[model samples]
Target: MSQQVGVVTFPGSNGDHDAWNAFANDLGVPTRMVDYRETDLDGIAVVVVPGGFSYGDYLRCGAIARFAPVMNAVREFAQRGGPVLGICNGFQVLTEAHLLPGALLRNESLRFHCDWIHVKVENRSFWTSDVEVGDILRLPIAHGDGSYFADDETIARLESNGQVIFRYCDANGAVLDNANPNGSRRAIAGIANEGRNVVGLMPHPERATDPLVGGADGRRIVTAALSALQVAV
Candidate 1:
């Protein structure tokens, strides 16, 4: 039997069910819904912080959600080397929690962007081992603050450590200014921690897991996590 995956639902989280469906129905793994107030992970092998306006994006995107009780458990899980994937607003939460490096700022366009964009895989992280470097996946991004920013030293460190997992790119896999939807630094769309166990991205992978909705490219991400967990076990 496939191991259980946990999908965390913050107060305003909107993609929790989408994540659960991707893991349970599409990937054939059992899934558990983890409420933001819950303090335990319940033996889940992997955890996903789905996208949405956590705490209504009040003080900041994820500033408030970072203090949720479930985040403490999520932090503990990541500290123990368990894989955690955060999408969109969830990505912001990861940064606020310091689980992942760098911060997401408002888009250079100063407007909310909601469209399909191509992202090139740059390195093999826990959630991207199934994809080859330079492989482009068309994923939908919906956020007003998707611009990734980090200081020169931190950016250099992340690059040197191979923590950059994805970069916004053209369909032909060219990393160019024209393809950068949110003006992220170095066109980065996703990144992982040094251990590669925690990944955070601005795109909504769960929304693309079903071909009926669009394409199944996002399924590879969930499967990669499952493969990683199985190897660890």
Candidate 2:
């Protein structure tokens, strides 16, 4: 009996199916699409909030979607120590929900950036237990408001508590300003809650699950999460 994954799909979300395929087909895991209007999360061991322009990206990247009914359930799930993974726009939503710290601001470049990028693992969390710190992962990012911003106090807390889970880096594992595509503070690419059960990132791991598209580094994340949970994959 494998733990089932729930991928939430809000209106205007475009990456729900992609995430579903990654888990259900590529990772050989069971998945259910939790609807936006539904406030149920029974039997979902893990919740995935995939990337997309939710609610037409109005007001802010995730401000509107944060009020969705499904997110309320996801928030409850996270509070109960359930694992949650948010990618791209999903990351924005997590921030809006306050499940993860820091806010995603408009890119300094003031333009949408869509490209394959490298992010170094900064700390291990529930979803990244199989990966070690300093490990560089290749993935894709697409967003206009992906820059991460946090108050000094919050930044200090995240740094001291090891909540910063991912940082942009080069191939040789060097964190450099040039490698930061979104101009996020300290090149932060991802983060985890204090409990480490909830994680949020701006890159699209769901897009890199197959080598046919590019590389398979994304599959490593899926494998790591399932393995960490003692779920057979």
Model 1, stretches more than 4 Å misplaced? Answer: 228-233
Residue 206 C-alpha lDDT in model 2: 88
1-233, model 2: which lDDT tens digit per residue? 44688899999999999999999899887788989999888777888999999999999999999999888789998998888999999999999989999899999999999999999999989878867887889999889999999999999999999999999999888999999998999999999999998999999888889999888888877665575345422
Angstrom error of the Cα, residue 173, model 2: value is: 1.1
lDDT of each: 0.91, 0.89
lDDT of 1 by residue, 1-233 (tens): 44578899999999888898898888877688998899988668899999999999999899999999999999999999989999999899999999998899999999999999999999988889788887899999999999999999999999999999999999999999989999999999999998898999999889888899988888777787676557645
TM-score of 1: 0.96
Off by over 4 Å in 2: 228-233
TM-score of each predicted structure versus truth? 0.96, 0.96
